[model samples]
Target: MSATQTRTGSCLCEANKFTVKGDPMLFVVCHCMNCKKQTGTAFMSNVMFKEENVDITGCQDVGQYADSNNKSGSTILRHFCNKCGSTMFGKPDETRKTGVVYIPSVLIDGSDAWTPTKEVFAEKKCSFVKELVINSPQ
Candidate 1:
């Protein structure tokens, strides 16, 4: 773990808040159809941390929506703020070795470290968006 172990974030309406301890496992920009539709953007950037390292508060205002199963049969859980409808994160159904916690870049405070390590579903990326030169899962 890095010397800086804590990071903070809040929902657009300030109704949901959370703190994440430890450094992120990985960062990614997803260009899948589900992410594009959910975020209304070319892609969605997420920072992955360990679930145990995250402390969440004000979850009563959090809302969850899941997209249809993907080709890999993984269910994607989209978490957002019900009060202001700000999308906050995506949680995959698959259990990760580190117990992943995915947080959206827009809701993160320490965004300086949010540089994406890879892109996913690059084939689905918008034509208007320039191709990102990063490792991709295809």
Candidate 2:
């Protein structure tokens, strides 16, 4: 994808909106227990991008929680909308890029433009979801 491509997204209530000015650096699906609990789903579709390349707005009621029990052991700030209780994004301190921000793939403006190459924390994935996927990528 070109670095110039732009993407925009918002929370369920549209109270927290944002724009990614450039292409994402990485995309993945996480089946970790914490991720599933946070999203209330079987897995989390996460997208990574340079923080400087993304823009945000309409966050008057946004809130965050410091998550420290993650795989990296480094503290991650989980940001979300306070009003709608939507999982918006996260900031990872020990990942490959410290300046990169983690966004939910559902927030991306389009579907065909983004694809998660791999899934993580498969060991913790639910049994019911295990029989669904094949030949995962990275």
Query: What are the C-alpha RMSDs, in order, of all predicted structures?
Result: 3.3, 2.8
**What TM-score does candidate 2 reach?**
0.86
- All candidates: TM-score: 0.85, 0.86
Candidate 1 lDDT score relative to the true structure: 0.76
Query: Quick one: best lDDT, which candidate?
Result: 2
**Which residue window of length 10 is worst by lDDT in model 1?**
89-98
Estimate, for each residue in 1-138, the C-alpha lDDT of model 2 and write its tens digit: 567977778989988888887767778788888889899999998888888987866456789898889887788888989989999889875554489888998876883477676778889888787543333443
Return the lDDT, model 2, position 8. 79
Worst 10 residues of 2 by lDDT: 129-138
80: Cα error in model 1, Å: 1.1
The TM-score that candidate 1 achieves is 0.85
Candidate 1 lDDT at 49 equals 78
